[model samples]
Target: MRSKTLGKIVLSLISVVSLGLGAAGPAAADSAPTAGAPVAGKTEAAGKGGPEGIIGGETADSSRGMAALHRNGNFLCSGSIVDNRWVLTARHCLYPEGERIPDSQLTVRVKSLNRTSGGGVVAVSDSRVRTEHDIAMLKLDRSANAEPVRLATANPKVGATTYVFGWGRTCATCAPSTVLKRATMRVESIDADDVYGGRAIRTSGLNGRTCHGDSGGPLFKLVDGQRYQVGVVSGGNAGCPDDSGFRFASTPTSLTWIQNVMADF
Candidate 1:
């Protein structure tokens, strides 16, 4: 059985702290340095390569609804456009467990593959966190011109192929990528727990895995040529290229909560 908590996972592998500023080195000059509050109850292995970006991934051709979250001008986490004025991302990306982040400190860039340029930036007007999960929804100050991603209604089958996108580091000790990256992973478990002990989907890298700076990124599955979001990046083994595994907050498992939360927006 998969461990039901992050503490067990951390004992065997490193936990992803913050993909934002200071987790990776400096970012490109055009963008502010990336950083986010550290995940609660997790420890990092100093100088050890950890989850921050896509390892063995390639440049994304397009990312229609992707959102690059920033805090005080610093890159923080990844998110997906679920509505014209709403985004879905990891709660940890906003603050430590049980803590809150002010709306004034958060901003989002959408409809662009590059986080540094070529997208509309909007301030976060409000946010709501799921008390039982790692996910959170942010309300934008204005409607985004980009199309929103569809949320999967069912759990992804085991061994199903999935794609993940992020602007996190390409490798441990590397700076966060300016361009978005995509990787292939296989569903390993539908019953896993995220860093915050929320329901999660576990995946193993087929061609690549998530690293730092990738927290809150989307895990997508294709159906009948259409893409649907199934999960959100949560945490993974220390090394991105390792076989330990990666965990994502399962979107389908929390669909009701998501709909309820979005209803208020």
Candidate 2:
């Protein structure tokens, strides 16, 4: 199934904003990519954040190290290797809000972003938007390099460093940059009072956050030698620097509940 109309639907997707960072400039992130850094090249737009509210906002700095979720050369979002065969993301990523998209109409390009690559990239669909889940599983066209990320059954530390990558917008004024957009987003617990997050959804991290075109990206938590993909790059309040410029993400653990959907394949 394919989406027949893709107009304003992109703007209406569900969004979650979390976190607040203080300092920790980009020059300071030489060691490990912080889990929550600013959006690459445009921290000012989303404004400054609180102490624990961090990010890895250096997409251009490291491309090889980060995984490319799209098939061709570029898309707004980037994906992580949750499994050799499946990539987790938001359902709105492929379908968006109010759009009529059929899963068969969607493609989960593994490494490439555009359409020129060899074609090993998977074309996934048949997504299931569950009652308690905001996650979607993309079926790869074929098995990938096979270095899958390890999922944390336990709770992820609030201040833990995490990396988010995607083909999302760099800045509001700047044209959406090509290549993968990598950012470090710190994990922080948003107030339970936040609208997007309720009992089923535990949210976290923000400040330098995501934007248009970044739909369906992956938020990864590195543990041991493996990366645990937790959050999907969803949408936000139109452009960055939204009033205060901060935002949050639906808990990555929500992705875990969708396991049975990908279990067989």
Candidate 3:
């Protein structure tokens, strides 16, 4: 169950406290550099060695329209397909405030755990951002032709086991991995006072953590063996790789907005 009603003042305070937290570390390059390759920001550990959840948690499969995005060979962020041509992610991945990057600069990969290989690739033709909750959608120039992941309709119960997927840095100071990763987390709370209408889902890592470059990744709940994406990676504390902090995300609390955006597109 969710917490009691929170006034706008409390919600504003929570939003302020959550700000400045990053989704993950900066992205890593897609290929190994020969020499003098520009090293991106540290912490792109998208399953560098082991995932950021329960230490021995198994890696997740890529059958659910999982995608990793890149720009000029540098890993950008992670996302999932919600429609034939629409990809869901965090707004910060493609924009700075109100500015949206041109679609020509972005590429999306699907159907592969290896970010560098094995997935079908497509160019982004457009993007839409909902800054209030840090959620966004990208329109692919062509269909990925893969089945999109199902979105969760109801609120995930507190204490329920959930999973997160991404291509973020393996640890706080380590380089970002090109392969996709998954970790298990437990629902901690619902930010009933979040400025975005209490859409924030706070989750505790079981064994692994979400580090750099994991922004826009998916938080999923399994229902009777099927995957339902319930949240989008948003912000968390800086104590990554140590497994001591909680990560927050945008969830179906804004389902109406998500549906509205998809319909508009």
Candidate 4:
């Protein structure tokens, strides 16, 4: 059966304060190319925001290699630093209606968990994406000066706990969270294909769900007490404040695409 194709609805990149990037960012990430549709289910409307609280989760102090992709100072989507000069994010994040936004129109903030304050900011020089999946690789004009995140060498176990980090909304109708929010979810399945025919890792979230504005956010798994990125936030059926939705992303399946692109960057 064909899964319902829920468009990639990345939250509007609205900022609380001016981060000096100007106000020319894309209005919203609504029409951009996306990873896939929401996990199997009829669409539901709820408090659409990312996860919160430490029910075994906590507000991350620093994601080390995390980066917030901004357009004209407005928050767009989340990305993971893969190399000193490259960031891995959802391909949909770079285009709106299939037209690629120029690198001059974007900026990447790194190091700080807080999106508005305390981070190294740099202009993007270039971006590379493949149509096979919803992943993209960005080249920074200069090094981010922060350590890049490690890619998982193997898929995570179905029952293992994983963490998601993002600056997505705190509520469906609320503004984006200023500080990076972190939540812990259990891996429910691996290698599940989304509506777009892309393989994804599905996770179960109770109090913590990946919501709007979290597109391309990193899903990390602890390997020997070290954080390794195993997935990227793609989409979910409903928003937050309502705790009954599953989150899915391109991870183990994306590793090859990520590596091939990074090698050329």
Highest TM-score scorer: 1
- C-alpha lDDT values of all predictions: 0.69, 0.40, 0.57, 0.60
Off by over 4 Å in 1: 1-4, 8-53, 96-98, 239-243
Tens digit of per-residue lDDT, candidate 3, span 1-265: 3332333222110110111222222111111100000111232222224433212233454435677666544566777788878888766566422355577877777776666666577888888866555677888899988778888887688898877777665654444454566777778876532223336777777757675556677778888877777777665554253443344445576677778888888
Q: Model 4, 120: alpha-carbon shift in Å?
A: 1.2
- Candidate 4: lDDT over CA atoms? 0.60
Tens-digit per-residue lDDT, 112-156, candidate 4: 666665667888988987564567788989988878888886778
The list of candidate 3 runs beyond 4 A from truth reads 1-57, 96-99, 192-198, 239-241
Clashing pairs in 4: 47-240, 48-172, 48-239, 48-240, 49-240, 54-57
Tens digits of per-residue lDDT for model 1, 1-265: 3344566342212223343442111111111112111233333433444334456766676757788887766767777888888888887777643347699878888877777677778889999988757788999899877788889999899999888877776665565666777787788998888877788888887767677667777888888877888898887765554744688889998789889887866
Of candidates 2 and 1, the better by TM-score: 1
lDDT for position 20 in model 3: 21
Best by lDDT: 1
| 96 Cα displacement, candidate 2 (Å) | 2.3
Pitting candidate 1 against candidate 3, the one with the higher TM-score is 1
Ranking by lDDT: 1, 4, 3, 2
